[model samples]
Target: MWGGNDSTFLQGNTNPVSGQVYTMYHGTSMEAAKKIRKEGFRQSVAGMLGRGVYLSRDLEKARRYPLNLQAYQRVVLKVEVNVGRVKKIDKQGHPLQNIWHDHGYDTAWCPPKCGMVPSGLEEDCLCIYWLIHKSLSLAGVIICRQTKHLQGCMG
Candidate 1:
């Protein structure tokens, strides 16, 4: 996800994926470097959200049903974005997630009115981009919780 038309590349002491890691590289142009940075950051955010969602779904189900898989709540709720750490709560706080999912909009086609949009976006690119990112984050928290629980159970 980190390529552009510029001659510069993203070079630094810290790894782009991990805020704590470090690295160094050369970019072809300043523009290229910036683009790389942005793309890297975007990928990192996306990865985090994916991880969070995977955890949250399990944790949420467990929390709501209290280990009674047979009594698990069959909620038809639209997926929410799990942005950083997630709390074991019933409601999500993101407005975009609420509006898009609850209102029955095809998020992939959401538009921003911009002339050009990222791949997978047919309409509101910007809004959809942010919404997707946030939703992933929200889901990620649950994934984290689920993983932790699984680890505990296994240990």
Candidate 2:
């Protein structure tokens, strides 16, 4: 009962030997973004998916991060992730839930509405070193305030 029904679940890579590249979003404070832009991403000590850099493929989800911060104070970073050897943690208390990384998985994924996340949004935890490839450059920035539009870029 804990693993849930695989038949109704969306198709995903359950066991992968190689890595896959994906575009993901990471939301953080502008202050922290400055540091990340300099040093690079760091792995979290603990989380739903254990130790890794948490990200989401959903832009809206990324936009709502640092939950306590106002929209204007938050920075949504668009990142390209190289998730190597992914493990699907679709439900709570999964056998490999927290130790996927130790078992050779470079990334852990929780699909949207899988009942694992309270918000029902998809989430991913990737090993810090593999989270970014090449250079972390700012492509563009869009400020959405009610109706007005302002655009810019950092770095």
Candidate 3:
């Protein structure tokens, strides 16, 4: 999962959330995570309006959330430039891990974007958005945009 400087640390081990008061894991896999969730760790903060993860389910109330429109525009332009380098593809035809360099996630990480695509559904097409990302240039930004226009855009 993508995180930021302001992210809160958890009490769990391995994962940051493990060390937090809410998450507890006994095993190394999903079973262990589930066990921890079932056990329920002690969290000082309880249920409240827009208090939990992602700052409440209400977008309107969370008016303080930050955004960078200029950065967004830059990324979009970068995507337009690199959308043609897509070589390999996945089952749904979305770009898979680039064959050359996959270090952008490590070297030039960007906050993950979602909600446009349905859960479990592949915006195999939207890889262009990331593939063209300037931070993921060269081996990372390799997508063919001309061939796929608005294929991933929902609205």
Candidate 4:
């Protein structure tokens, strides 16, 4: 998600009474990044908050967890960028083998942001955010279960 140097990591906190740890990540970004993240989050949120959009139970679980604005924002932003990347990759008709790594868990093989560039470091962060979000979108379940591999926030 959109992780800033001062941002905090969203963790799965247990209620103590329930003894359940909710896994999450929290981070922040600039206005541009936030916009992008909002889009992605909207899509995933629909699936998680709305019923049967993506045929997933994540929404149900997400609904129960305490809201961490930063982490939730990051997840949304990541989804937006990821959807765009998948669209770009599909439009180019790139081979699945080439689009993804052979190991299946790696995303380094995905396409780069060919023409999109930011003006400065702030914008650059947004660009990177989009790229990473796109890759994660393509990964779907593979990336969802493993929060350890997630990047973006530095804080």
Overall lDDT per candidate, in order of appearance: 0.23, 0.68, 0.20, 0.24
Task: Estimate the lDDT of model 1.
Answer: 0.23
Give the Å shift of residue 85 in candidate 4.
20
Task: List model 3 lDDT by residue over 58-131, tens digit each.
Answer: 11211212232221121111111112222222223224233212422211111113222222211112122342
Q: Model 2's lDDT to the true fold? A: 0.68
Please tell me which predicted candidate would have the highest lDDT against the true structure.
2
lDDT of 2 at 134: 31
Which candidate, 1 or 3, would have the higher TM-score against the true structure?
3
Instruction: Point out the higher-scoring one by lDDT: 2 or 3.
Output: 2
TM-score of each model, paired residue for residue: 0.15, 0.76, 0.16, 0.17
lDDT of 4 at 113: 32
Best-matching candidate per TM-score: 2
Per-structure clash totals for the candidates: 37, 0, 15, 13
lDDT per residue, candidate 1, 1-155, as tens digits?
Answer: 22222222223111122111111111122333245334421222232112111211122222332233322221211122222221111122434432342343322112222222222111111123433444321111111113423422110
Q: Per-residue lDDT tens digits of candidate 2, residues 1-155?
A: 11222112223323322455555678888777778877778889999988888887776677777789877677777665556788888999999989998887788888878889898888888876555643233333323222237533232
* Candidate 4 lDDT by residue in tens digits, 14-53: 1111111112221223443456444543222221112111
Q: Candidate 1 versus the native: TM-score? A: 0.15
Candidate 4 residue 69 Cα shift, in angstroms, is: 18
At residue 14, candidate 3 shows an lDDT of 19
For candidate 2, the TM-score is 0.76
Q: Which candidate, 3 or 4, would have the higher lDDT against the true structure?
A: 4
